[model samples]
Target: MATFSTRYSRLRDNVEEEPNSSAFDEIIMKQEQIIRDQDEDLELVGRSVNTLKHMSTKIGDELNEQAVMLDDLGNEMDTVDSKLNNVMKKIAKLTHMDDGKCTCSQT
Candidate 1:
């Protein structure tokens, strides 16, 4: 895409070819350093993701344990409620008896 007028400028003609090789080497070195830094950053991100996964798994296990304990507590409360209802029914029957007197005969 070089136009004839732009391709042959005075500044381009005056530059020496010796520095181009050294400049290209420096550019390659800088690119390599940038890639190494990117690799390190990706490794750090991977470690962080693993840590987050481990923490979430532990929290899930703890939640499951708590859910089981809550279920047991609910079952115990139901049992207590059933016992209390039976006691209440017995008290009601006793109260309905003839003014708290029993109908037993004397020997």
Candidate 2:
């Protein structure tokens, strides 16, 4: 039977000249399980990042659309303001004409 220290040394180093097979196999299995768990964690993080990226893109698109709509509304309001100014000018001219006209005198 191998000494306790010899068995411990074999377990610690994977490149042992005379590996105790059961201990090596156990170590490999545990290491594989740890690697799998790490892979799963990395995959979860990747998915989360992708989701956030998509949401950010969506938000940016919506903001762009809103800005365009605001620009259009501003342009339309300017047109309406110009038309209103013309109507006011016409009304002022009509008022001046009325003031100059003589009132109908009763016979």
Candidate 3:
């Protein structure tokens, strides 16, 4: 029977001299490169997400500012409309006033 150390050594030498060993090494290297590329892609995606979040916040702020401005403009228009209505009423009253008696003569 082969000794344990002899069997282990035979197995190790066989693995080292195997025809496909280089092919396995090449596959491992390719896998490692793929993982590194994926990591870089994930980092870029994270940065893009953060940038989008900041832009969304700015847009929301601008929308709120515009809403406040529109409300102020609406209030100013209401005030102007009320003043105009009052003036129209005063004009109508003046137009309804009686005119002094007038006589016309023809020769």
Best by TM-score: 1
Pairs that collide in candidate 3 are none
Candidate 3 per-residue C-alpha lDDT over 42-96 given as tens digits, one digit per residue, 9 for 90 to 100: 9999999999999999999999999999999999999999999999997766666
- In candidate 2, position 27 carries an lDDT of 99
Residues 19-48, candidate 2: write the lDDT tens digits.
688989999999999999999999999999
Off by over 4 Å in 3: 1-19, 98-107
What TM-score does structure 2 among the candidates reach? 0.57
Q: Where does candidate 2 clash, by residue pair?
A: none
Candidate 1, position 68, lDDT = 100
- lDDT per residue (tens digit) for residues 1-107 in model 1: 87665555465554655568778999999999999999999999999999999999999999999999999999999999999999999877766686877554459
TM-score of 3: 0.67
Ranking by TM-score: 1, 3, 2
